[model samples]
Target: MNLFPINAGNLKLDGGAMFGVVPKSLWQKTNPADANNMIDIATRCLLIEDGNRLILIDNGMGDKQSEKFFSYYHLWGNHTLDGSLKAHGFHRDDITDVFLTHLHFDHCGGSVQWNTNKTGYEPAFKNAHFWSNKDHWLWATQPNRREKASFLKENIIPLEESGQLKFTSLPENDLQNNSELGFDIFFASGHTDKQMIPLVKYKGKTIAFMADLLPTAGHLPLPYIMGYDTRPLLTLNEKEKFLNLAADNNYYLFLEHDANNEIITVKKTEKGVRLDTVYTTEEIFN
Candidate 1:
């Protein structure tokens, strides 16, 4: 199996929101904020090429939203999803599966796009089967007031409308071994209900798609949860368990929202599991 890091785009978000109650004095050391208190974020998707099945995990926020809608996020970057796919000698149409970690606008928005006539929305990848679990599908479709803004109908409804939506089998516990997508899935709910974190076996190592469970290296600290998470206490427990597992097993965390750090490894330190080493995509994938 071959894997590639797909750069969808970059944007900036309020550091306070990203790091929750963590003081700026602390988070800023690792994720330094700009003058506007906005920290850099990347929609880094992952592409898995295993024979005929080309699976894409979380295809960034698409370009369909209005300028006014995007302005709030302060989008900035040259890395278009199309350009990144082409750079790796592929296209959206080549994707067979779109494994969404969650239905947040940034993670799954690129799954659907405006049709040619611009009359209505349609599946962006004509040939790909969009993947989400029953729990997450229900949570996103019937979003609570706290997460309503992040779960946009335009970004989600079209996949089901196109008759290409599929659901992975939900795990009895938090972790599902060897899912339909051929990888273990770590189900996390603190960030959002049933956010599936893919644990992929690549090149003799486990590469975890650290969705919002661990957005950036700065979030390694257990208490450094995102303010967006609905259940911050649950997140603390989940992160503690997962981080210890990752550290003990020596997993390479593939960070999706970290613009600066691509992949990171954590070790069991005296304080706790702290960042051990950082690696660029080239260093690992190549």
Candidate 2:
């Protein structure tokens, strides 16, 4: 199997929200904020090519939202889903599976696009099967007030409408060892309901796709959790468990929302699990 880092684009979000209750003085050192108090965020996705199946994990926010809607998030950078795929000698249509960690706009928005004639939306990857767990699929489509804004209907409905939506039927306990679409799946609920984190085995290493559970190196410290999470206390417990396992097993964490740091490995330290080394995707995958 071959892996590639697909950088969809960069966005700017409030540093306070991203860092939660962590004081600015601490987090600012690693993820410094701009004059507007916003920090750079990357919608970095992953491409897994095994056999004839090309799987894309989270396609990032697509370019279909209104200008006013986009102004709120402050999208930046020249990186795009199509451009990034082309850079790696692939195209959107080549993706055979789109494994969405969750259906948040930044994560799955690129799964659908405006159809020709601009009358309606359609699956962005016409030939790909869009994957989301049943629980997350329902949670996103019938979103609660707390997460409604993040789960845009336009980004999700098209998958089911296009007859390409498929749900994973793993039992709760089976998540840890279950492999699907060429990845070992693990589920976490702190960030969102049934968020599937994929563990891909490549090059004699277990690479954990740290989707929201541990957004960046700065979040390695137990208390540095995102404010956007619905249940912060649950997140704390989940992070503790996952980080300990990651450090103990020497898993390389592939960060999705961290703009600067690409891949990080954690080590058990006097201060608990902390970052050991950081590497770009090329350094690790290439």
Maximum-lDDT candidate: 1
Candidate 1 lDDT (Cα, 0 to 1): 0.94
Off by over 4 Å in 1: none
Q: Report the C-alpha lDDT of model 1 over 25-96, residue by residue, as the tens digit.
A: 999999999999999999999999998999999999999999998999999979989999999999899999
Please write out the lDDT profile of model 2 over residues 245-280, one tens digit for every residue.
899999999999999999999999999999999999
Q: Model 1: what TM-score?
A: 0.99
Model 2 TM-score is 0.98
The estimated TM-scores of all candidates read: 0.99, 0.98
Local distance difference test values of all predictions, in order: 0.94, 0.91
Provide the RMSD of all predictions against the true structure, rounded to 1 decimal.
0.7, 1.1
